[model samples]
Target: MIIENFSSEKRENKLNQLSAEFVVAGGGIAGVCAAITAARKGVKTILIQDRPVLGGNASSEVRLWVLGATSHMGNNNRWSREGGVMDEILIENLYKNREGNAVIFDTILLDKVMQEENITLMLNTAVSAVQKADEKSIEAVWAFNSQNSTHYKIDAPLFCDATGDGLVAFQAGAPFRIGAEAKEEFGELFAPDEAYGHLLGHSMYFYSKKTDEPVKYKAPSYALKEIEKIPRFRVIRKEHKGCNFWWFEYGGRRDTIHETEEIKYELWKVIYGVWDYIKNSGNFEDVDNMTLEWVGNVPGKRESRRFEGLYMMKQQDVIGQTEFEDAVAHGGWALDLHPADGVYSELSGCTQWHSKGVYHIPYRSFVSKGIDNLLLAGRIISASHVAFGSTRVMATCGVGAQAVGMAAAVCKELGVQPADLMEVTNLKKLQNELNLTGQSIPNIPIRPESNLLTQARVTASSALTLSTIPFDGKWKKLNVSSAQLLPFEANTAYAFKVQVNASEKTTLEVQLRKSHNDKNYSPEVILESQVIEVGAGEQTVDFKFESSVADQQYAFVTFMANPALEIKCSEKRITGVLSVFNGENDKVSNKGKQTPPQGIGVDEFEFWIPERRPEGENIAMEISPAIEAFDVSNIGNGFVRPWGTANAWVADLSDTKPTLKMEWDSEQPLSEIRLFLDTDYDHALESVQFGHPEEVIPFCLQNYTIKDLNGQVLFQQSDNYQTINAFKFEEGFSTKGLLIETEHPSSDVPAAIFEVVCL
Candidate 1:
């Protein structure tokens, strides 16, 4: 005989009361990442989403491409990728939905959330009511699920508002601001001179398909009758579809939160009008078979109410590239300011200004200034309008989400509020925990409390290697004795090697110049030069320079075009280190066809020219600077920030047997051995836009072996592509030293690592 816990009336009412350490609102990637982080940290967490599917803008309902540090479309962004849970999602997506299907992506997010047993996820449940525990704390949230006709009252100690519109914050009475701030407010340069209540606006998207048979489109009754009256409507061509129709926006003057429904209808009307014009207009061809495949009813919004936090990100901090001690996340996207009038503004789609390097996002931005338990994530976090323009990107918001989630765990564990975690010691613990979990916070190394790796002396296989290349026995001359003019963008110091062709045994004087702007790609300041002489045919010349023009964003090498010189160029483009000019139409495939090699799109400039375009990964330039700025000990130093000079260990490919060894001063007690491999310390595991435009570079050590000092094999992994490597002994062991042998991936790449922890 069994006894029932609930009464018949209670069971009939379908009321459920649940409790957890954290309650997350919104099922977008931000909320999902936050919930996953907390759940993985052993905190009892519950995630609530108003929609059935997760991933707010990236969901099937509205497929906004994940654009982050790549700055939407690569405005000279280097070593950019949002790692941690965001990268984990991307990797899983690549493995399962390599084609980037929206539905598959939805399932992937769901699968990840479901995998964490500590998290209780409620779908299609809207949080309608909140019960305040006190003036600053939320005791419980009452939500309703119409699908199941049930009411859920979730009681939690901490809460996160990952909702794009900041609904949770609004309902909780957390102080927030709507619309743009005046330039005088935060002394912002990008802000409007006068304050305006107008917002960026709402946008809907549609996709069209080409069927074999003819298809027709009937304009919606509410579609704008005189589409020509609208600004920028004439620019719409039939070819524009899906994410391409980002300009179909509306509702700038109206309250985006209160009048969201009205904005949605307005954007829909504009979309239909644009679609009708594309199909009916005589100017558009190849529309005989095109039909609307999918249209977004749910508008993806840009800005709404932003809750105030302990610290607000300002424009100066972003563009100035301030090195903050509390930077928990980073963004490299330009300060993209769109007109408040949105779709109807007679201005360029948006104005953008690039940053010198990736800008930092502080943890204080997520902590609520007033609400004790409330934390802000995603677009709703505290930031000026100018800074919001960059921070609002999906990938950056995702990074903030992980940060806030990890902080929430610390709050629950320490029995403290979100605001209390900002103290130095407390923050260090949280920061170290985040780094241990693969989240990168710039400059800040994981605390040196109990790390044993710092105790071991670290040495690597090869310390120096010169860049070398073997050509396919082909060369082209620039009408004068010259070396191929290879262009690149380098934010920091770099070493360069160029392949050149010379006639009559001439010496080449390489003059390095930095570009003044994106347009007119010609260099401004004449920095330095290196002389390399080559014999008649094809030859590779190495130019090792000490002084680097690290201040500029653009750099190019022009070989003095003499009659005795021939310049050879390659197609492959390197990040900040190398790439050939894009405007070369004379590119010939190795098959001797008229196919041009894929190169950088310097479409705006006509200056830089390529010689005979070599196909494949041929940047025609290689740079391997001395890693003296970094040492082997930098790996276990616990500073996990990508690209931070002190955060990684780089081995030169020059050595015959490239290896890394860790020797203890004496026989040390070692229970576990952890190895971190350098998979290109700067290039993160994050990608924005459609799927992954790039992959984990081949810089990752492909083959490696680990041995003890007594010549004993402990562990061996031959196929390695991941950035982090960890190993734990079942019991415990005492050893004097450890040996890490790194073999050449092919004969060019060397071994590299970020951190190695010994426990």
Candidate 2:
């Protein structure tokens, strides 16, 4: 059945006028991040989302956790380093709801992009058709919103198809491929010998809140009762909370868009039926009131229309067989395929292929070979079915988004087409820019540490022998005291160096043992045959061992008997300090040692600031202040009270007037300062100013400016209107004294700052 709204007139007036330099179609994670990246680079960017919210699948509608690389990968792995806008979103969300689970993904992501002034968001809008003057380039695109019955004709120099489904590419006449490919085409190991009308399945996620009281539930009409009797379906447990492609029983070998709607309805039926069986069958008698919390409105799509670009990513490239000069992104997810027959079967088993480290994703995969300006990102990038399976994860898609966004910015700046940016020089520049923003670019090798053990010394009463070990040079000798213990653990191992002032040849036996029940367990010492030689300055030794304690326990070894040796023992002790607080008004102390007033407190504390000072004042102090837990109505009021200052004031501090200062031990370079203000209280802050004292200019500037203490302007902005405005300083610039000048006089506005963070 084809349905068309013939009476609906295109209301063009409701559409926002095209004024941005770049336009991003789709408001999913990739689209939002793309828009934010472009806007952060000072480009006028407009983000168009078909839904009312941002985050496509990872939103409240889908509720998918954001997964990155495998656990064996390094912390700074390729998938983990896709920063820029994505990092900002994660940091903001993590800071806001540190204790809560990862349920606030959509709200946090949306707020990040929506908060940016340069990013104009158009929600509930769908791209209808592309208007191109030339076959190679897009002049403008027409979009319509059903809610408002409006059509938008957006014109921009550069365009990004972050629409997960390749909607823009398809509408723009870009050649694309969908479903699985034959093995000979991409030579994918998992691909069938011949092309089959099959593709990965989509899933509709649902969540249930556990309870104690029994609640009855009814199975849906479409519940697969007969299929449940099958061995494959019977063997699988339905008690687990998460259901991905496994719930994908059907919807293959059909029109994806059309089948998706029907699949969603069927999936919902199965989901409710499972819940009903659990509630009524007495199996979940203890689980009372197990109500459905969320049912995914948007299906988590696995396969889609992949646009054919200058280069097509193949399975061999993903298997680490090929490398490219224009590599801009990488992926490492397994090639997981769902059953094509729409029923649980053994063939639905997921396939895994190991790529040693990161695999390259070329820049040519972004823009279509058929269309010049249209750059496709996210899961819709040009890749064979098997390759797409690996690169289709959210983390890999984020990397692709970063590449496309940076490419779009470069094209807009250089006045070149997307295809033209694939040259070595241009691609290198793009890679460098992405790297600076902390985004991972593939094939650019990472040099390992030359020396892992730097200045290693052993402090023990017994004689010890040190041996040089060979392994991957990439491992850095992390500070032993900085190692963090996992949950259900008490202590961490300590290792360090010892120096002998006086020359005394002594036998020192180094040992490794478990410290439990107030006694050493399984003690093993590496004894030296001869007396160890000691130098006048310092004797360095390196030793590595693992603990055998169970349940994430810790162990440390001490000399069995104190051996007489003229040496100074330097053992590495845990340096990080943890503090707990009672309430907003209570003072926080370190293990009941030093009590400090806690106006603003945090549950967990990890201080990385190189320097600390009052926002305006320059006097510095070296104090490892205890991290406290407190709550403030506003962040400005949450700070340690300045000497002789009583109340919080909002004044135009951009100019030299109304200066404040903070003193700390070290010097920390600041990119931006976030001032959390209590807008609900007094509604102060008409206009604010901030800059270093050196660049004193007595003018009521509308935007904040980054300057040195000597008053040299580094950067300036006029538009960000959020209360948490981050004044970013240019590279190679350092400034002190961030003044908050207000639009109204200090006497008129009563705004208070809760917290001031420089990141």
- Candidate 2 lDDT over residue span 1-759, tens digit each: 998666677633576557578889988778877787778777788898888777786666665554443312211111122344554454454345433233455667767787789888889998888888687778887888888877788898888998877877887788988777887776665677888767766676666776666445667678655446333544434445545324544456556666789877766766666666556555544556676666666777777687788888877786543668887775655444566645444563444443433467888888788887788878898888877877787766776788888888888778888888877778777876665454534435211121111111111111101111112112211111111111112233333332333334444443443322211111122211123444443345333333333423222222222234332321111111111111111001112111223421111221111010111111011111211111121123322111111112332222233333332233445555544332211111101011112111111123444444455555565533223345555675444343333232122122233345455
Indicate which candidate wins on lDDT: 1
**Best model per TM-score:** 1
Score residue 515 of candidate 1 by CA lDDT: 50
Number of colliding residue pairs in model 1: 12
lDDT of each: 0.69, 0.51
What TM-score would every model get versus the actual structure? 0.81, 0.60
- The CA lDDT at 245 in model 1 is 72
Query: What is the lDDT, from 0 to 100, of the residue 42 in candidate 2?
Result: 76
How many clashing residue pairs are found in candidate 2? 50
Report the lDDT of model 2 for residue 570.
16
